[model samples]
Target: MTTDGVEAVFLETHNWGKAAKFFQALGFDLEFSTDHNSGQLRNGDGPYVFIAEIPEDREPGVQIVLKVTDADAFRPDPAVEVVTPFEDTHFGTREMTVRDPDGRLWSLQAPAKK
Candidate 1:
């Protein structure tokens, strides 16, 4: 299936506060913050950025979230590796994970069906 393009960037950081402040300094406005030390930020009309705090021992990384209008209708190409099927996310969306040829993980996100 085809994606509508990146919807957001998911970032893992060791320090949530510092990460948030850094993005704010880049002119991105905080859209909302979760009690669990994660938040969404936006700049202009581009894709929003979602940053979450990970344990200090964990390596921080970034993943691009591709937008799918309908998850149920998504069909990966034969060469694509589907790591996880679409599942409801706590933040209110349906998400699926896939592994690229290089072993990098990418997320596909679709609006929660009403």
Candidate 2:
């Protein structure tokens, strides 16, 4: 599968409201929101920002979501350990999660099948 580039970056935050506001102040437009736990802000072309609340036990950092042409066909490099294999998500996309050598989380996703 070929990668299209980053689709979004999920930023774990203690306060989604403040985070969204901060990004908006910096010129991002609020595209969508959820009262449950997350919201999205976008610059319109690329680099959509998603902020979600997390428990204290979880680390607050960025999780990159890369867009792929076919997530099911993409395989992790043998040298790089994978945390999860491709699975269908409730949001309707197929996705997988992996950790790089530096331990940063990377999520690979494909557009939902129509």
Candidate 3:
């Protein structure tokens, strides 16, 4: 399936509060902040930048989120690899994470089914 566009950029930081402040200072308007210390910010645009605390098992890195019209019907080229199957996210979205041949990670997200 074709992607709609770049949906967001997720950055893993050790300190969410400090990260949020830094981004806000750069003019990223706060969309919403969660109790979990994560939030979505944007500059009156479609794409957003999300800052989240890095999980214990992983190193801090940037993940690109691709917007898809239908996560359930996302069919990639047969030759393309599938790293993680699409699944529901705690934040109310359907997402799938995949790795490119060069080992870059990509996440695809769509609104969850009503």
- Report the lDDT of model 2 for residue 87: 81
**Candidate 3: Cα lDDT at 92:** 96
- lDDT per residue for candidate 3 within 1-114, as digits (tens), equals 777999999899888998999988988999999888899899777689999987668889887899988987889877667788789999899998777899887898998988
lDDT for each residue of candidate 1 in 1-114, tens digit (9 for 90 to 100): 688998999899999999999999999999999999999999999999999999989999998999999998999888989999999998799999999999998999999988
- What candidate 2 gets wrong by more than 4 Å, as runs, is 56-58, 75-80
- Top of the candidates by TM-score: 1
Tell me the deviation in Å of residue 45 in model 1: 1.2
Instruction: Please provide, for model 2 over 12-103, each residue's C-alpha lDDT reduced to its tens digit, 9 standing for 90 to 100.
Output: 99878888889999999998899777898998799788889888788798878988887656766687677887788997888878787898
Candidate 2, position 60, lDDT: 96
Q: Clashes in model 2: which pairs?
A: none
Models 1 onward score TM values of 0.91, 0.81, 0.85
lDDT of each: 0.94, 0.82, 0.87
1 or 3, greater by lDDT: 1
